[model samples]
Target: MQDTRATTTVAQSGHATEVHGWLKWLEVVLVTGLFLAAGFWLRPDDPLHVGNTFAWPVLAPLLIGLRYGFFPALMSSLLVLLVAGWHYDKAAATAYPWGWAAGMLACGLLAGEFRDYWERQLRRANAVNEYSLQRLEEFTRNFYLMKVSHDRLEQQLAGSSGSLREALRRLYGELSQTRSEGLNEESAALMLRVLARYGQLQTAAILAVEGNRNIQPKALATVGDYEAVSESDPLIRYAMQERTLVSVQTEFRKHLKKLDTDLLVVIPLISSTDDLVALCVVESIPFFSFQNRTLRLMAILAGHMADMLCQRDQTMAGSHEWQSLCSQARRAARDAEAFGLPSVLLKLQVNEQDLATLADRMTGLLRGLDVIAVNRANESPSVVLLMPLTDELGLAGYLHRLELDIRENAGRSLWDFASQQSLVVKTEAQVAEWLAREGGAID
Candidate 1:
């Protein structure tokens, strides 16, 4: 139906153009006939003798050329030629006026060419203007969408609702109290409870993955009426294959019709080392809560859970310094990306003895939000300070104060003891690269 309507509209437009063109040609004929009539009436014996004075008949073709371009002008010039031929035949002249005919044709053709050139330029300018208008409309729509999204996010983050950082802090504190060697059954259940509250999930379960490939039939933790998910379920398979979050609204759009399982979303708990630890499957979620913002929030929570489990696993394996640094760096990176917050990593080369002496002093000099860690396992001992919510100016102020305090307390400057390097954390990959270059491993 739409195609037929579009065809009809185009046919109507073509008919209109044809009618308009015919009218223009008719005007050319009328104007040229009037010029010939007036010439004959003024001087019947020599109607074409105006060539010696002012060739007024040429004005008909020139005007038509200037108005309607080449074709109408050509028509008018042909009519004038016919009149000249008749006049010459009546006068019984032996030779026709070839020079006068050429002059009339030349005026029409030149004027028509000039008209055609400007018309082509006008069409091009119109096309460019139309394209620019379309682009402006698209940009305006996108800007409005972004503005609405920003306002919604601001409402979620404002007042007593508490920030995402606070919620994650509570999650970590709860999880830490339960286990020392990765997430146990109790801690996993606690994590699920927290997720259910924030995600507005009615039914969800955390299923353990054996060897990061096969999922266990029994769920380690569950919220609401949980059921076991089949290994062949498309959503499960896609989430396992992608090692990222999958939902009916996102990556599962293609297989949505063929989806065999009753799943709303699947959240993967992946360790910092890229190991698939487990899967958090949502059997049911609130209609309103199942949106892009909610999915992103769930992903962030899933990351923090993975970090906790991985931290415990690494601690059991006796890599505390690396795990601690990885957790802090990941948190800083996530905060920076989400909230446009800044964090600076200050690395100072120092011996183990100096670390023991200055760690307490540095902690006193820094703000409460700042984090300090000592790495004594490497051949050359060093200290890493993660200053959260700090930019370049804040780092300078802290450094100056630290130097002044160190000089007053020990009668020596900070540079005399240790050389330091600092970086503003933006992404986890950036921090990892900085660590590798500074003789430290992020993983």
Candidate 2:
């Protein structure tokens, strides 16, 4: 009883909602004290003893309420009442104990219910927080992808707009002069100077290969500064033999180590007869290397220049020029571009056989782009030029221009309607394959 009384008193003193070990012991001690006090104070001979008879037991419920809470109150009340009833033999004493126990039991049930309710509420709040955080992370990821896609689209549109304006300017100029030289050497030189002035580190040179004594006329040959690289230079030899252009760092390791070495580009050209190879070299130095698109542009410009030289020679030589000029021009106008830009894979095609002659012509004609290689298709005799801005309208405009150019220059059409359809189908297939390889967007 003393232990129970001690436990109850300790429980009564603690924070109401928490059950503590010390309180339980204290209540035990407290209960024992009450029982002992009542037993000692009672007088069996007195009538007042009957009323005081159930006092200890009745007090037990109240004590339990104030200390051990509802459940404990109920148990203690029942115990006390039973002791009182047995001692006094009064029905009223026994009834009061049961009533006290019942009241204490109800209190305990209410307290436990409230505690459970609070626990459930806490769990719900935690779950909601976790779900919200996950959603926020997903939203952020999607937002970045959308932002990047939007920016890329915008850049492409701007570039397209600029190209259109430039083309329009050329059309207007052509209506007036009607002569043939769209951009002369002077103009081309000015473009390079401007690019250089704008911090782009512009470089220009030319190469012509007619039977292979590579010749550079303006910049490559006479910048007044010459590197005595003969046909024997390993980089040059490797480039010619492999018939593929290699990066300067990968090709000319010794030059790459030189602090003064600027960026260098090598472009190759093959003639119509598949007999000549021409190489063009460009040298520049800047904080950043040239972008892949720029490198490709260099290769393209070289190819165009080669075709022009071939045209000039044939035209100057007159009518029976083996129909040579027209053949070269036909091949030149058909090629287009479709490679990924800003990295690598820039290309050009040439159709010539006389190395020295081809090299000399390529050197004079190529201005900015390099000549990477000159090779024949092992499987097909055709040249492929990936069309830029190539939706239906773009294709229509390109076809119209190409047909006119080839017929007027060479008296022959590159491809008729059916042929062009086949070419487009092939190009589309190639584009699909390339997209898959690059992990880029599909058309």
Candidate 3:
């Protein structure tokens, strides 16, 4: 398929080149003929008169040089000289007409060289612009990814304590219970409410992504006086295209053709699938503290909101459950080591039958601080559970409960499950070693 595409591209390029060449030659012929006709019409009745037709021929070569370069212009100049020599007296043509022909050739050559120089400069400028744009895009993507990693780390830290874990579990339970289809608008309104409370931004709006990939305002939450901006505002368009947060500035405002509002920032809500699901635009508060970190936090919240808006009637975790668990485990490991907190890593090999039911039971058994990740590298799939701040006694009790639950609910005996548990230590290297021992890397 790739070879066919390559062949097609080459064939199309060749055809375009051939057509361009023919058109260029045709232009030369038409210009040359026009020059010849003009010379004939302006020729003096007496042969020795040598009228202003001598000067008229220069236009042909000058235009040819500007459009088609030196060689074609030189050819046209020579043809003009031949016509002049044929129509005029030999003596008169040989003297000044030869000088005029030389002047025409020099003009064509100089103009052609200038044209080539201009084209070279333009190509270089375009190349530089393209390289700069590529670097900018790379920087934006990396920055956004960094912000996402930071947000995930914060979540991991928040889930480290027992009380926070309980709170998170309750929150997740509530969200799952309330999950429904076509709740995008409510989700956007909820997002705006959260953003307003946290950022202290009075005015805000959420734009949802449509089927055509265009974002339209789905919800607008306002507290005080705010400017009304259209759904197709330039700031929203910029954020969508760049997939990064943008600050409103004079130049961007100019693009919008209106500066009615005190709009401060535009946040892109990118999903786990890397889709830009929505945009959140916020108004800046006067005398309120604002910085890059603030915007980064807002972006993180907006990302969660985007996930909510894109959710359907499926598992509340959506398709990124595995990835989310892996990220949580890695972050928990780092935090455990940094804070000298106890943690346990459990690796379990379970029967493939009723895997989904087994997973759900395990999820119910574990705290929000704990993560369950599936490792399918081996012939049979296995599960790895990361429990933060759990001591040996806690690990033992949890495993016993998990075993009883599986035996009674899944109708499996204790022998159907093979397991290993290790105390998590300080440092990423130690965590990596633990994952390696479990037959998988920290994804």
> TM-scores for all candidates?
0.54, 0.41, 0.39
Please name the candidate that would achieve the greatest lDDT relative to the true structure: 1
Model 3, 1-443: lDDT tens per residue? Answer: 01111111112322412225556667778897887786556654532224544465677878877765666677777776676676665545445556666787788777666655665676687799999999999999999999999999898555332243343344334445444544455555556656665555666676666652665644544445556667666666666667777776533645866644446788777643356766677765433436554554566555545544444422322125544554445545544643455677776676686456667777889776677877665667667777866877888898889879878986876546664556554566677677665555543
How displaced is residue 118 in candidate 3, in Å? 99
lDDT of 3: 0.61
- Tens-digit lDDT track of model 2 for 1-443: 12233322222233334546676646745774565455547655422233443433345455554444455555555555455555456534434445544544455445434444554565587689889989999999999999999999898655432332243233223332424443344433432332232223435343445465554443422122334334444555555665545446655554544333343655554433233335645555343535554454444444443443344333322233223323322333333322322111212223333323333433443322222222232222122233322344645564566556556655665443113221232233454443233222222
Point out the worst 10-residue segment of candidate 3 by lDDT: 1-10
Order of the predicted models by lDDT, top scorer first:
1, 3, 2
Model 1 misses residue 77 by how many Å?
A: 88
Candidate 3 lDDT score at position 408: 90
- Better-scoring candidate (lDDT), 1 or 3: 1
